[model samples]
Target chain A: MNRLGLGGWAILVLAAIFFITPLVMTATFSFWEGGDRYGFDSYRILLHSPKLFESAWLSIQLSLASVLALLVLLVPAMIFMNLYAPRLRPVFEFMATLPFVVPAIALVAGLSALFTGPEWLIGTPFYLVVPYFFLGLPYAYRAIDVGLKSIDLDTLTEAGQSLGASLGQIIRLVVLPSLRSAMLGSALLTLAVVFGEFTFANVLLFHTYAVYINEIGQHDPTEAAALSVASFLLTWAAMLGVLVLGGGRRPAVGGR
Target chain B: MRSPLAVFFIVLFLAVNVLFMLAPTAMLAIQAVFDDDGAFTLEYFQALAQYQYASSFENSLILSLLSATVGVIAGGLIAFAVLKDDAPRWLRSVVTSFSAVAANFAGVPLAFSFIATLGTLGLLTKLLKTWGIDIYAAGFSLYSIGGLTLVYSYFQIPLMVIIFFPALEALRPSWREAAENLGASTWQYWRLVGLPVLAPSLLAAWILLFGSAFSAYGTAYALTSGNIALVTTEISAVLSGNVVSEPQIGAALSVGMIVVMVLVLLASNLLSARAARWSVKS
Candidate 1:
């Protein structure tokens, strides 16, 4: 540890505090007792709050739907871009980065305006999923693009085609396996974005886990903090899950 | 190139992009310029002279600049610390994964974590007070521009690591060795070779961070509870029918933000084009 140098150790400590402090404080605070100060009280509180379950389950479901939509929409386009539409790849790339350029608040504003006529859509979970899909596009595209880029995707396609393999088999047996790491990375990233999202969910008035936590924070901070810890852990698990389990060797498609 | 299924998916993707991405943007721009009367007017843009709106713009600009600057430096240091060969490989992987998660980990819960960490009655604040310094009484409040910068920098630093990592990882140690072989000192090599190689991307990265911080809404909103008047909050205020109930003006603020982002991005694009040329040379 001493051999790691002052600069190295300093950075390690900085990261530890920055990453862990809130988590520790929140975990400890969540179990707070106004009467005695620590137990399973917060979890018990969380258990009784059906709104918590409704919102959390809704978030997970919506996140799954969004991921399904993203992979379905993105993977093929990613494959097609490199394989056939190389000229249009730049245009598509520009479009993918659009979400980053546009502020999330602005997106909420514009989207709300878009749905001002059909106000009913505002209340639906899947409507949130649509914008959520758009929200995840930039990261998902970058990750999958890295995954697609990691191997000689174009050459693999050509080889598969010439060998009389069907396109379905090419995507399934040829592409998906090689793009495994990218797919996993993209999936986790998309899930994390959807799960942690607040602006769109709040503005759209949908009760995703983040929105629920924010609402709960306003009233019961201890419980809110517990939920925050849980929220962070869920995303962290997804994150570390990808890092540790997604790849057999080093992650070829590192975070973008 | 033109398989039927591929073509269908491409059409679907384009349709969704147009409907969700392009169309909403066009709608927002229109609302910013037009009024409830459905006629063209610059009243909203002209009203930027108002204190509430203008301050938000100014605050956002300063906040993003400060955060991005510090974030890049911190991120660079951590990237080096973790990515080194002798350092624990687990820590490196954890850092990389954490950045990916942390970069997306913002909004409400993030704001709560910050409050617990550094709010006026925050744990760290109280902890430091015992050591002879009262952070809040020293005029450091978590509900101000400084606080927003602190929160923004947390996410911004990790983003810098994520964006900067691939490039940094690709830089072979042999380059430094080769430079040393030519009698170049560490500082000399970095100054002459290393900095030049990385200069453009660094600039590009700073701009990206700038945009990220600039557009950020949730953290600032949750932390300040509408106390800080960054553009995003101002837009939210107007949208929620709080200070000024004019949705058009909110749209105008949104437009103002979009304009700033466009300019920043255009500059980033220019820097990246130059960056491509720089990389090609080596």
Candidate 2:
């Protein structure tokens, strides 16, 4: 029988070391108190900090808003294309995937260069939903596309049409129900992006959760480390959500 | 005969994307060659040849190239090991899932993790000091290019594993068995049969990794605190209006980055498509 010999085990061990060491050290260092003393004082202070919850709440809200925006924008258009303009699939697919070429930093820079909007527009955090929606499109489109590919879209539409249902009714009553898992997966992917995105928040001066971490990190490394642990867990939770929900066929790429 | 509703929906999608997605990008390109008076100019593009801007571009390229190479080799090895016939199903699933999380577990938290592991007062640094091995004295700084490479490998390697695993999985065992029956040695079998099939996927993965590392902003910003010369940090610095207050230069830098990324991604897509063709044929 085939067996993983010495070389295979060795590679796995090295991977474990490489992957686990930073996490282990970071968790341990989060408890460091001055010289050699160790305690949970950093995390305690972190938990007590008002800004932590405020930033976290803002990030969560942004994530929800972005996901909602993504679904509303993508779902109807995707359904319409599938039902009527199927020939436009290639063009639509190209547009949906083009976001991959636009990095977050570049997008922020571009927006800043072009932004002649009102001061309040750049002043608030909610404006981030726009860029987050853009960043989320490629991933969400992929997930939704996979779902649309699997379902019998034409059959469902025809059945609803024969039942005297209107086009909008067919979408709402028949197709939307089948795409629930896909939408959820896309939402989770978008949630991960909004939660972890820093460049736009930082450059635009929005002070979202990742930007908040950068702020705390400047003076308090321990507290920042504690926050770092939380952020890592947050990403893990969202990624796991995507996997378990079977929304993303391929591993999703996140915003940096 | 497109329904009125479908036509409306399609138009709505196009309008939103053009206004939001395409507008900013087009504006960036426009600003790069345009002055404050809305007159066309190439001053900003010329300014990219300056030392600070030029070096940042050079550093970003070198960093991406180095990190991608390291990720490809290490991740390829790990993928091969994990996909071996003897590896348990649970182990495969665990590695696959871990790669998914780790690949996305980048940016600020990742920077903090590296700092806590390698910084002057970091856990491992202190431990190693007690053993009389001073990494700092040996000219190792976690804020430097080398340090960022190591930190980047954390995500890059996992990303490679995630992307490369499926390609490796498609490499059927029957091909290897056939090669062996044809009196080929293991190394010869791999050289003649395995590497050729995998070459395109490996190249595609490498380029994607390069693009990921090149486009990265948050992790580099957090770890280096803008100390390092990187296109991303440079773009952010200018946009922040504290470094130079030159929006045109920032636009140019970002446009340059966009061009590089577009080229890299296009190449990767082409190679991946070729790889997919082979996979299907096999």
Candidate 3:
């Protein structure tokens, strides 16, 4: 029987306090109704809000659209950049990842300024996905790049070309399936990012899930807490599901 | 040997980045330097030195530096415990995935969750009070810089673990073995061997965390209720303002943020580039 060291126990306890406690507290406050009782009133209240359902549904739809657009933008560009224009790889990486330094607030400020003349854009949720696409790009590019690097893009391209395979066959049959984990990983990441995103949706006056949640918070803190827990847990579950389904190496974020 | 079609797609990708990322930032720079009539003027940049702008910038710097420092220390310790110490398998994977998740986790849900834990009527605050401590009476408000720092560190710690652990892994076990053969203590080994190897990446990671927290809006927005004047909230206030008065002022603030981030990111990039040379241990 190995006894855990005092330091090990301390780290675990600290994790409980720092990471686990806030979650437990939020979940509890979510369930804690007034008049000395615990009930599902908070969640029930959230459920009854047509605004909540409507915005959440819209957020899901926009997020799906954004992920599709991201794949369309990233995959071909990445494979072509890797296989053909290898010299431009660093420039490509820099530009794609540069937005990480720009805060969501800053991007929202810029987009609103850029879209000023197009007062029509400010009216709909359509333009909101553009910024969300930028938000997810850095991570998505990294995920796809990791996948490309794992399978030799050069060797695969050469092999496909020798067999008289078209670029479409190479991409659809050879490349994407080999990079399946990363594509799925990127899509899952986009889903998590879009639902949790606030600044872009809020400033643009769109009613995404996060914007709706903040509005709910203004009127009712308890219900907001309940919804926050649910949304957070849902994201985690999706991430866990992706890893499980991938059944291989999960796309690492910062690892080389 | 490459086809023209391949070249077009690469150009197209660059255009997307330019249109979405660089152009917006350029708009910020232009707005910051130009007046209402579109002629060049430095008024907005100059306004950055005033009390409203200067103070918020200062608050952001102070908060980011302190939070990054504390987060690096705490996170480094946890990463060491999990990686070097042979902790349980379950614990390692949990910390790894949680760090990845929490690293991306930001904005309102994060801020409100902290409020649920430590706000005036918060659970932790209540717990502290039961133990004969009144945080509010002692001039501790979760709406202040101190409280914001506490919340910022929560994500920062996990982020450090995620980004910093790779370098830790890169420190070949042979280095430790060699250090021990030279009669070095654990502290000596880290100081003489590990510290030098990691210093650059550590600094880079710290800068990344600082930039992240400095420009962060949602957590500070919800926790401080926009009363506090961090740069993120300052910019957010103007951009989200109902009236279209002086939109360039918000652009000026964002330009300030971009400048700081650009400098820090450049320095971080140089440092990491050097550090990568060190990690080519194979």
The prediction achieving the highest TM-score against the true structure is: 2
Top candidate by DockQ: 2
The runs of at least 3 residues in candidate 2 whose Cα sits more than 4 Å from the true structure, single-residue gaps closed, are: A163-165, A247-256
Report the candidate with higher lDDT, 2 versus 3: 2
Question: How much native contact recovery, as a fraction, does model 2 achieve?
Answer: 0.82
Q: Candidate 1 recovers what fraction of true contacts?
A: 0.64
Report the C-alpha displacement of residue B63, candidate 1, in angstroms. Answer: 1.4
- Fnat values, candidates in order: 0.64, 0.82, 0.56
Residue lDDT tens for model 1, A72-135: 9888877877777788797788889888778888887887766665646655678887788888
On residues B1-282, what C-alpha lDDT tens digit does candidate 1 reach at each position? Answer: 478888788778888888888888888888888888889999989998799788889999999999999888888778867776678878877788789778767778888888877877666787798899998888998888888888887789889998888667656677888898889987897798777878888889899999988988778878888777888888777767777468888778887888888899899999888877745334
Across residues A1-256, which tens digit of lDDT does each residue of candidate 3 receive? 1135788679768875788888899899898887579999988877788998899899989889899888887788888888877888889878876787787888888877887756565677878777888878988888888787777777777888899998878877888777878888888888888878887777778888888778877777778788878877877776776666554664332224
**What global local distance difference test value does model 1 have?**
0.80
Which wins on lDDT, candidate 1 or candidate 3? Answer: 3
Worst 10 residues of 2 chain B by lDDT: B273-282
lDDT of 2 by residue, B69-174 (tens): 9999999999999888878889887898889899998898899889989988788998899999999999999999999999999999999999998888888888
